[model samples]
Target: MLAAYWRGEITLRKLRVLIQYLPEDSPARWQATDGRPFTIRDAMMWRALWSVATVAQQLAGKDKNAFENMPAYPWSKPLNQNTYGSFGDHTPEEVMDYLDSL
Candidate 1:
């Protein structure tokens, strides 16, 4: 999916909902929200990635910022907030490179 996104197979909106890749993985993932895994299941991964996805969505929207709050789920809403917190940073390109490396 990450590779697909990079290759322009998928839009930023889909990518955002799909992943963020967290951290603390025994084996790093290529498609991470913050640091989750190859697949994104978390609402909140990295704010940086969020920022990128958000911007792309907004730009593609009828009006910029329309979907500004694209993946506005409680990233670090609660339960995991205490332990995992919010990832808040990372780039898709970096993740893509990582995936390629693997």
Candidate 2:
């Protein structure tokens, strides 16, 4: 869905509930209460990615003992908060910038 938005296959309003991405100088941009230059679509993508990373961390932590005890070559543990936390460090703007680069 996010890719579709970037491809212009979907409008911001189509993917999101009520938000629209308009020009910075457009009247619609000023009408928003959030005062963000972009629309909810970008926010939603950031939130969704963050939520996924958090859930992944929780699942990894749930089996902490099992992962720690595993005898894998090179002696590395499974994924944990430390591995995924960096993903959450990115702001919505940074996430959108990355997506745009793709």
Best by lDDT: 2
* Residue-wise C-alpha lDDT for candidate 2, range 51-101, written one tens digit per residue: 566567668764324333322222234334244344455676797799899
Instruction: Write one digit per residue (lDDT tens) for candidate 1, span 1-102.
Output: 779999999999988766654343424452344443432344345555666766776677632442344443334342223243323344556666876999
lDDT of each: 0.52, 0.53
Report the error of model 2 at residue 84, Å: 18
Regions of model 1 farther than 4 Å from truth: 1-45, 62-102
Cα lDDT over the full model 1: 0.52
Off by over 4 Å in 2: 1-36, 62-102
How does residue 80 of candidate 2 score in lDDT? Answer: 40
Q: How much is the lDDT of residue 17 in candidate 1?
A: 62
